[model samples]
Target: MKGHYRKRGANTWAIVVELPADPVTGKRRQKWTSIKGTEKDAQVALRRQLHDLDTGKLSHAEKLTVKRYLEQWLDSKARSSISPRTHARYREICEKHISPAIGKIRLDKLRPLDVQRLVDSLPDKGLSRRTVLHVFRVFHNALERAVRLQLLSVNPASAVEPSKPDQADIAVVDSAGAAKLMDEVVGTRLEVPVALALGAGLRRSEILGLRWGDVDFDDGRATIRQTCQLVKVEEPSAATAKKKTPRFELRFLTTKTHRSRRSVTLPPSVVGLLRRSKASQSERRLLLGAGWQDNDLVVERGDGKPVRPDTLTKQFHKVSDRLGLGVTFHGLRHSHASLLLKGGVSMKAISERLGHVSASFTADVYTHLGRGIEEQAAEAFDRVVKHER
Candidate 1:
């Protein structure tokens, strides 16, 4: 038997477990322990030891620390599992939050109370409630992997209560504010970007990643193929740091999700505006001649390089603030959904338009906008009664 227990006294029992043969000596190995409890307790102890031996966790448990294991997990994840931005965020959470808290503890010795203490202490570290929750999730996910790999019998994080962050309000621009925004950007560089955002509801990265070839002027359509990301450049080792390197680099990545890779029909006004933008870009290309760098990007610098996504967000905020709109660039996307919701559009339609994963998620986000729909429903009922009369 792999394990067995025998009663030794009125309240004591002896447990014996068979372990794998010693590698060097090729001799069978066994373990024996005494339990000062009932026969059931001795049986449990015997079974636990057998399971640990089968999983091989007993060998690594004493040597592996939380910080070392997490670093190794991140290195494996960096290969192909997650996007570069997500990997960077995960690493930041590991190094800045998790490691500082419980990283020194042996992985096998980690307990639910230890995890709870880490969660409780994060707010004192000046982290926001949302960020604290994120750290908890990352740590929980790592521990879950450990359980699946037979490194742990259970995930300690599963027993800890997660921090609940207050939901922040979603800001949206009213129709009048959207009109004013369009009017203000008429002759400025913000024209096309603003048009795509307020007019068609593209994310800032998607707007910056748009290429001329992705647009169809005649069909009034644009395909979302890629997105731009500003990723932090990894610090080089001492030898490589001698060479100068930029702090950040812009990269073109695929869409955020399968749903995010979608086609959006442009409003006619946006199409017309884009036509003008194309003409203007052509003139600039001619002026630069051979010096022009043609990256085929629809929105770019005069020399034909992609616009940094943050620069677009800052410029958009500047205009919105000047106009007293109080709306951020992303707020414009919320405004787009608000405007559509007010026009009797269904939540499912808006979800598909915005490339959200599900209509229910879209409805939850724009639930505040449902008052207008309720009002419209009441008006429709009154009209039916009047027609019957």
Candidate 2:
């Protein structure tokens, strides 16, 4: 019920608290927690411990290892809160990066230096700065939950500074280059997807998740409401003796952001292409009769099953390489934005078409493509001034 602090050593204090009697032993119980700061800090620690005891929020035991604690944190707190893709990514980082380095260390005994060392060693392990930063964030978030639970006084990972990721160069092809790539993919299954990417600026997942119901051929627009992605599945261990399933499971999820679910007006050419593609699919469905999957997906295999995003990327890469375009599938999206910028379209319009969160974000991403427009603006200003004078 009451707690007090006593100096254990120079700058060290121990907080001792009395608890209710043990039911089995019929004897009083006590809890002692050591603090390593000033007198004020020791008093604060005592108050926190007494409050935890009063509220029954005290941690079970200090014997929990970092690995075990992280696992528990993910299952109990993270799994339901985060997106499935993010939860899986966090688990992968913890298992592959953090577990091997400091998993055996007790959670209460983890130090800032220990976390820093783990972060510092990531570069030597061939991880990029971005990946290292992601790993640190995941570990830091897990440790933060521990602090909130009163399992540790502070998050050790917070004291560690991971390397910052470098700004990646945005690669995009010009209209002519995009046309050349499209020419190469013409008459192929990738034609419609390439058209959608270059014309509507759809992400690969959005393109794959496109359904017939989402397209408005009459209005020349497409609504982006969902995205398809392949989530990696953890294989069962031998002890579980479960039957093996596919390594990855395909799932349809909400768009990357609420703003990402906006509608994009398709180009006339893209609309025409999609119309033809839809007619062909209808004919194939009738030919296959009851054997058809009838998923109504816009981009799918010969059957109605959705095409994997990876498969689309690979095919795009192969065609780009064959044409010497050197443009990624995402490059088509960049090209779409670049062409719109070059055509003097407003950033707000382009941003809305691309389903970007904001016009400023669209402008920032396409700033490099705006240099010519800046020059044109300067020339036009000079001409108007000279004519008026």
The candidate maximizing TM-score is 1
Task: Quote each prediction's TM-score.
Answer: 0.81, 0.76
lDDT of 2 at 160: 80
Please tell me which predicted candidate would have the highest lDDT against the true structure. 1
**Which stretches of candidate 2 lie above 4 Å from their native place?**
1-30, 33-48, 51-61, 81-83, 108-111, 144-160, 237-246, 345-389
The alpha-carbon lDDT assigned to residue 76 of candidate 2 equals: 68
Give candidate 1 misplaced runs (Cα > 4 Å): 1-48, 52-62, 237-246, 375-389
- For residues 229-327, write the lDDT of model 1, one tens digit per residue: 898776665668767454788888888788898999999999999999999999999999998888888889778988998888888888888988888
lDDT of each: 0.84, 0.84
Residue range 188-251, candidate 2, lDDT tens digits: 9999999999988999989999999999988999999888899877677666658644378898
- Give the C-alpha miss distance for residue 309 in model 2, angstroms: 2.2
Evaluated against the true structure, the overall lDDT of model 1 is 0.84
Report RMSD (Å) for each prediction in the order shown: 5.8, 6.4
Which 10 consecutive residues of model 1 have the lowest summed lDDT?
A: 18-27
